[model samples]
Target: MLKMLLLFLIGAAVSIDLIAGQACQPRSANPGRACKKACTHDAQCRGRLKTCQCDNVCGMSCFNPNLACNDPGPFPNGQISPERGYGQVIRYTCNVGYNLRFGNNRTCQSNKQWSGVQPRCDREYWHFFIILFYMGEDL
Candidate 1:
């Protein structure tokens, strides 16, 4: 009975150690975390937090065209160029009969690097007659 009990305890300890080792192991993939392996293409970095997919490629980050400086930085050698930076200004002009609904001008500040929201062009009521007359010419 004593020998049998000792063998059972040893087996239990080994099993617990194995479980603990597995628990400490790194995960293969996580939504918000970085990639576990190097990727070679964008497809490999498709999850929510884009990571370096290829062996030497850089990861993707948030990018907005309207903002002045939204560059994604450089990629691996011969993979991407780092010379480019993000633009800070975006220009918007209203149509002939439409007036800008938001402020006409916006500026990119030091901390506020994001581009201003696009202003909507509101149609002018006075231009309705002119537009109708122009449409009549096509008929």
Candidate 2:
């Protein structure tokens, strides 16, 4: 019984990574609190990639508990939401009157990075047209 218990404890402590060899996962990850405030480091985060960033919308949190992808930081005139980490669906939005040229929301992949070109916020003429239409403008 003692041996079996010991084995279980050890297994629980470390998780295996299939691609990039073995990586250590902090056994006691974000216990008790559910990221009420901003997380400053890896220990504050939970799951595999363990990324922590303070978001304007969600505060310092691992939206994707399985985190990774170095802080992409804020864009020119836009922001990334839900935190940058694995399994998280990253969404981009521009400031008032600005528009996203082409880039779209993409997932923070398992390899600790975003999958494709991060979008940019620009003042495009088309954006005004779209907004006007939504505001009940006919033309």
Candidate 3:
């Protein structure tokens, strides 16, 4: 049992190291690292024309937006489309009993940002109080 537990601990450490090694670990000490995509980031990229990607060895750098768009990550109470690429139309759908407020679909544009605004997955009961409060007005 002791040997098995030790082996498991070593295995877990190895797994963690391997995972972290494969990721884009940021290197801040050396600013002179010459990479093709240098100084690229959502903030560093100017004029909304360039993209801030981290594929370069010098960490996140600015470069022209790629044809394949990156995933927009998580939504609070909604699900975003799985497909991510240029010209691909993504859909935003709210979970059951929730209302999708704003844009439902967005095209992956040339710029890094998605076209138009994303939807807010609002709860069905969320508006009840506001509507009741505004009952006196002609809403």
* Candidate 2 local lDDT, 1-139, one digit each (tens): 9999998999665543333344435423433223333454557767665555433223344445544667766688888776665556778889887888667686655445565677888787887688788999555
Best by TM-score: 3
Model 3 clash number: 3
Please give, for residues 5-111, the per-residue lDDT of candidate 1 as tens digits.
99987754332213123212222344233323433334554555443211101122222322234443222221212222233344455656666665544434222
Model 2 residue 57 distance off true place after TM-score fit, in angstroms: 30
- Point to the candidate with the largest lDDT: 3
Q: Rate the local accuracy (lDDT) of all candidates.
A: 0.39, 0.59, 0.62
lDDT of 3 at 116: 68
What are the runs in model 3 whose C-alpha is more than 4 Å off?
A: 1-66, 126-139
Candidate 1 least-lDDT 10 residues: 53-62
Better of 1 and 2 by lDDT: 2
TM-score of each: 0.27, 0.40, 0.42
Q: After superposing candidate 1, which stretches have Cα over 4 Å from the reference?
A: 1-68, 71-89, 115-117, 129-139
As for TM-score, the candidate ahead, 2 or 3, is 3
